[model samples]
Target: MFDDLISLCLTGSPPALPQDWWLRWSLAPATLLPLLGLLAWLLARRRRPLPLVGWALLALALASPLCRLAATLAAAHMVQLMLLLAGMGLLVLASPPRAHMPRPGPAAAVHGALLWLWHWPPLYAAVLGHAGLHVLALALLLGSAWWFWRAVLLAPPPWRGTALLALLATMAHTGLLGALLTFAGEPLYAAPGARAWGLEPLHDQQLAGLLMWVLGALGYLLAAVALALRWFAPGHPVRRATPAH
Candidate 1:
């Protein structure tokens, strides 16, 4: 059991690990330590501390090594992606520095392009094969996702309509991509170790696609509604810039 746990923690490869694999005490120092440092710095500031909910979400997303094991299944991988997006969204929304968000149209286009490019077979393979590349992929995805959500949901009032359109566009594009993946006759990527988890490649791909299509698009639609509410609410106070820390 101990040997199996060690193997599971050491690599994203699979041998159908036991449930305890998620509870292992392993640390991804390269990922976790910097985040912890940031949390500490935020708390030490004399001003209002950062949001605890945001920090907690990020900590759970980055510090838990279970993501590695989860990647063995495509459906599980989608869940990991959703968790990272949620964490990053919370962190960005709740951060003290209020940078001006980018225009939603260009931001959405860039985000969609990145998603397609990264999910290409060669890139996904590289991510799985090299630990460093895997980290880089996650970083890029998190950053892009943060930018996308910020533009869609947090844009200033003047750009709210444009933001809504951008969100809708993202929903359409991503949903289309997901549909294609779901209906594809064969597995898109021949990822190693997928079979070790007893996953049927085609079905796994479909499941991943459905998650992206339904859940992802639903998230965008909800954000659009939230933005619309804020924009049209009666006598809403003009949102001030976030105070400097």
Candidate 2:
């Protein structure tokens, strides 16, 4: 039964039939148990709607049919990553304000490094083939993203400029990676399953790259713009108070 459960959790190969796509939900105990615990905690404490919504999005990305699709399609995998990052960002934004968060510069650097490391073709291919490695990769990605978001969002007003710079730097690196993938002459990922979905491997890779280049960078871009606007707004924490006549 344990082996059966493990087999059930494995995404296996891509679905060849259209109906199989919608039916393939990953009810992994490793994923579902923690999500259930989180849900109970959220309900018990009566958390705000934003965190709840974020939790739902996280569940959708990890436990829904999307998880199975991600195993086969690079583009679907990109969507899952984006959803996880966005969900983590929302959760951070809704959390109670705290002091002494890590500096955005170091956090951004670590997150960017991890992002690049995971995208290395050989490593990524291996991860997709092994469920344990795939989970570990996602855990590390989400952990770093959480740290980066917290650093940027919770930094003191005086450090907002630094945060903004870090955010833009992240955006730049991710966009550059995406551009590289998009323009590569051949398929970077060995996704033979893409043919089952009527997509050439190169085309699938390019689509994934486009999603990362545009959609992935969008979150950071919006955050950077907001931070800049707040920095220059009247009476902001970083702004000097004007003297009365």
Candidate 3:
């Protein structure tokens, strides 16, 4: 059992992990840590609301390195995405005694530029290929949004709010940003020097950009509705002053 846990957490091997395998293996522990906490909370108190920090932690998982592998392998991406949603979904469902505890909710005032940063604009420089980072960022953004949608429904207040907002923003940002591609006179990502994804270089990147914007629009519409549900719910922490009749 110990060996299996190690394998699952470190390299999916019987302990002979390759250098790249270590990354996925490393992620499993961080993802499982919350489950450990949830287990402890459940054992201590059979029934009680989960803390808000737990929800925050969950959002972090969906958006960051936790799903890094998912962005690399199409098949692995689907599997990891499901695992992410399931893990976080179950944790939120129980709402263990230690959860639903809030920690530094959304800022009182929002900045347009910071909001832009949250979109995490393409570095446009670090990319080994002009379009590599852009393509990669889209994969991360869209994949996380899809997986987190299920988790959002199962998440606690304010968390659901933040997740929903992030989802909405990602969609919008991708849309506006993707415009650069759709309108560029020539293909930027599949040029002679650009990296190729088994296609004519830049072909995949151009298509990817179109899909990113189109999908982003769809996510925005769906997430907006989800946010509305939270807005209407009584006592939702993210809700602002109720509009007067």
Candidate 4:
């Protein structure tokens, strides 16, 4: 029985089209079992609906046809990465973990570094070709991003300003990376079957860059603006303490 399941988990070659992309979902036990366990844990703890929603996003990124699509198209891979990062942000915001990091700056830096490192052309190509490296890249990317979001979201009131700066910094770095990819004269990363999907390799990379630049910056910018609003609201504790003159 376990052998049968393991056989289904093999990392197959990239799918060629006119293959039905929607039907190319991954059935890897290694991915599915852990996600199921996490879902059970979330239910047992009775976490809020938001966290459950976040978990569903993570599951969709890993188990749906998007996973197989990522193997063939750079744009699809960027979408998968964005889904994972967005899900991690949602998870941390809804149910923040115990804050061990006293400041958001370092966490943000680490997270940004990991994001840039994985997207470096050589490393990106190598990781895409090897299953183990791909898994490791995902783990590092998600874990660091979660830590960064948690630190920013749960910072003490005194640190809120710094947290806002951290968010902006993240937005800047990711946007810069995206712009580089978008404006490059040639494709820096390889996509095995991009042409089959009507995208040349350079076009695929540019689309991915646009997704990261616009969508990634938007997520962090929205969070920063929300935090700023909360800090400045008239009913905030700091503002409410002003003496009645």
Candidate 5:
């Protein structure tokens, strides 16, 4: 019964993505609670707009054919991996620009979140099972983690400190979703060579859903940690002073 409802909602017309992870992720303030902390730190010092690595991460997440490569190991996976690494290489060199500086409250929060949403999730479940695509997604995320570690996480101190935790969440969320589908013996998404990889179709679908949660949560947490560290760290330049009578 519930399955019927899910199918209907997801396929009411070729589907338009279940829930908007990108939407909320973009708004850095509300979604990324710690963003203000970092902004304060950078702004207090009167530094040039500090670079924001999220944009680079966003781009790499999008550039791939699958955008997320949630398939059954394939050639496209390798290509996608190569491209992700390459993009990360470029991000390291080019450096992302900071938000258009800060602004008033509620309004600014909305704007920042919008910026974060551009980081695409690829929604690979739809087409990633070509065997070619599977290998690509895994490799890209794992491989890029290394290349991006320094440039993305390290470059931004606070952002760096919390990135690992957030990243793990992203991976776990999606993996969990996929796992659930597998356990239920239902295939939300299918890969041609799933059996070869020893994953039943239903199991493959479960993995995809799991991956969604994994990456989605991780991406979310990464932004969150970066923002949090910026917020709570002691002696932060942004700490407001008490109003004097």
Candidate 6:
């Protein structure tokens, strides 16, 4: 019975990708709406222009074909996770130079909870099994990450120390989770047809853990550097800059 279940799970790979897989991935309903919203934002603020980098990152995060194609691989999913959580969140906060930063305490708790919950093996497997649920998970991750980063980046100068400590705590906790996955003797998840790609489930899981531990933590480190620079760089009150006409 257990062997039959394993075989059944192995056969459950993603639907055959179309010849126009790139086009489909890019134009997927999940991918398109954010692109349009970004375009509208750019058009509305034409006179007082925001940085293009943020917009570009947002487009890729929301519209890239790589995201859907890579879903079959845990590593790819981790990359997508980073793109949405760290990449898109950071870029969006960087856009409006003067937005108010939220309080770190609540934002950190929510973000940390969302991050850990979605990555739990059962929930992660469920997400892979259902397209709608996968989208919902992405939405929740992106939203929570945005809130967390906004709070971190927009923190007033006085709160810089607290923000830094919060970031360190986040990095430590998330990295610990990644380490747990990395060192586990057996696969923690039976992801959709994970064997179809010729990867053993344990190896695939290790790859995902490495991405989270290394790449995800790297994102936080970069943010920490940025924050430290802003906080400690000699005597210029870091006021929000007015967008240039």
CA-lDDT, candidates in order: 0.67, 0.78, 0.41, 0.77, 0.37, 0.65
For residues 1-245, write the lDDT of model 6, one tens digit per residue. Answer: 11111111121444213343354235544456666776676666663333345566655544555454455567666776776665655455545535445677778889999989988888877776666676677678878877777777767665667778778878887898888888889988764435666678789889989988987787788888888987888995876632222
- Write candidate 2's Cα lDDT for 47-164 as tens digits: 6787788888898887777776776778887888888888888778665545556788889999999999889998887777787887688789999988999888776666778889
**Candidate 4 segments exceeding 4 Å error:** 1-12, 16-18, 97-99, 237-245
Per-residue CA lDDT of model 1 for 48-82, tens digit only, reads: 43345556666665556455555566666666666
Please give the distance, in angstroms, between residue 135's alpha carbon in candidate 4 and its true position after superposition. 1.7
Off by over 4 Å in 1: 1-20, 23-25, 41-51, 96-100, 191-198, 240-245
Report the lDDT tens digits of candidate 5 across residue range 1-245: 11121121121222122232122112323213334553454455553322334333433343312332312322223233334433443333333324331112222233223212211234454323233444453444534343433323333333433444444443454445434543665444434555655666565555544444454445545645765676558876642322122
Please give the distance, in angstroms, between residue 189's alpha carbon in candidate 2 and its true position after superposition: 0.6
TM-score for each of the candidates = 0.80, 0.87, 0.37, 0.87, 0.33, 0.79
The order of the candidates by lDDT, greatest first, is 2, 4, 1, 6, 3, 5
Poorly placed runs, candidate 3 (over 4 Å): 1-31, 34-171, 181-197, 229-245
Q: For candidate 3, write residues 1-245 as lDDT tens digits.
A: 11212223222233221234324433345446755675677566554344334444444444343333323322222233334433443444454223433221222112223323322324322232233453454345434433444334434454555656655665566577556555556544312222312444345445545654575466556656856676567876642322122
Stretches of candidate 6 exceeding 4 Å from the true structure: 1-24, 46-51, 94-100, 193-196, 238-245
What's model 4's overall lDDT? Answer: 0.77
> Model 4 over residues 1-245: C-alpha lDDT tens digits?
11212222223464535467677665667777988988887787786787788888898888777777776777888898888888887777565444244478888999999999999988887776676777788789988988888878777666678889999999999999999999999998877778888889999999999999999899889989988898778877642221111
Error of 2 at 118 (Å): 1.0
Worst 10 residues of 2 by lDDT: 1-10
Q: What are the per-model numbers of colliding residue pairs?
A: 0, 0, 12, 0, 40, 0
Worst 10 residues of 3 by lDDT: 103-112
